[model samples]
Target: MLVDNHCHLDFPDFAAELDAIVARARAAGVSRMVTISTYVRRFATYRAIAERYHGVFCTVGTHPHQAAEEPDVTAEELVELSRHPRCIAIGEAGLDYHYDRSPRDMQQAVFRTHIAAARATGLPLVIHARAADDDMIAILREEMEKGTFGAVLHCFSSGPELARAGLDLGLYVSFSGILTFKRSEDLRAIAADVPLDRLLVETDAPYLAPVPHRGQRNEPAYVAHTAAVLAEVKGVSPAAIARVTTENFERLFAKAVAAEAEAGAA
Candidate 1:
């Protein structure tokens, strides 16, 4: 089985036919998926998806692109929302200098808020860093000193230095469908260096679909293609990559699995 460690199933692309989307993911060997939250104001929409599908899980966060819109979202509010049994992680939050959709300072502030929430709740943070490697690395280092927190450098396409920094901080690194692109040879080199136990795979679906499916709407089901690419880069069988990454997902999101099991028993 494969676990897509990050995706956005609640997006409009799947809203009208979410059941079929989930079924297709399962049929494609995607046994589990983590639906990412972008805007806190619409988190309930994300939560509803998780509630409806046994294999679906979610996070509560404000993406950097939406940071300006949610400037007042306090760490306490994030911590409170994180108490939901279905909410497994703290963010899809971080710096995004690529677009600068939000003010840099505001994005940093919100990222710090999410780091606090992750620390408070003991859940892994899902980071979305882009074109702000130095700042992201510096903030992550500072926060690590203040307190320990779990985090994943989601959809990593950064330089090897940032990857090393994140791994040094004992955080996991997740590869998205972007890894499957032929132009991602440098990225693949970085993937090869990352230890299997610290690695994860995701679709970031409704977004970066892997090759053969590139330029199309991505889904959790396409993770297998990324996995195949990662396996090739790491010189391991796709099954091995699947097992390692799935184990990493369970370990990093331990609370989510436990919460889901408890809900089942209830």
Candidate 2:
């Protein structure tokens, strides 16, 4: 089974058909998914989705782009929200200078808040870094020195240095549909060198749809294509990639793992 470690199923793109979307994902071998939150103020909506779906889990935090709007979301607030069992991860938060929708300083502030929540709650942080590797590395190192926490660099497209930095800090690196893009040879090369146990796969879907599905809106079902491409890059079968990433997802999201065990035991 595969787990989409990151996606935004609550977005307007999936407004009318979560049923069909989730069904498609299951049929394509994605048995689990984490519907990420873009704003903590809307966490009830996120929690509702998770509660209604058997295999879906969620995170609670504001994205970096909206850092300006939710500037005061505290680590205490995040930790409290995370007490919900289905809220299995801490954020899709980090730096995104590509759009600069929020000021870099504000983004850094929000990112630090998320890191603190992760540290406090012992949940893995879902990091989203773009176009700000230097600052991202500097901040991650800064926070990491204070205390260690679990994390994954979601949809990684950064320089080799940043990738290495994340790995050095014991953070996992996840590949997305971007890895299957026509000009992503460089990314594939980077993917090849990463330690197998530290590599994960995702479909930051409704966004970067992989090849063959490149022109259309993406969904979790398309994670298969990205995984296959990743397998080719790593010179293993897709089933191997699926097994490893699923294990990695469970390892990082310990709450989800425990919940699954409780359900089965029930």
- Runs of candidate 2 exceeding 4 Å displacement: none
| TM-score per model over all chains | 0.98, 0.99
How displaced is residue 203 in candidate 1, in Å? Answer: 0.5
lDDT (0 to 1) per candidate: 0.93, 0.94
Model 2: ten consecutive residues of lowest lDDT: 257-266
lDDT of 1 by residue, 1-266 (tens): 99998999888898888888889999999999999999988889889888888878899999999999999998899989988888999989999999999999999999999999999989999999999999999999999999999999999999999999999999999999989898998999999999999999999989999998999999889999999999999999999999999899999999877987898799
Q: What local lDDT score does residue 109 receive in model 2, on the 0 to 100 scale?
A: 94
lDDT of 2: 0.94
Give RMSD to native, each candidate: 0.8, 0.7
Worst 10 residues of 1 by lDDT: 255-264
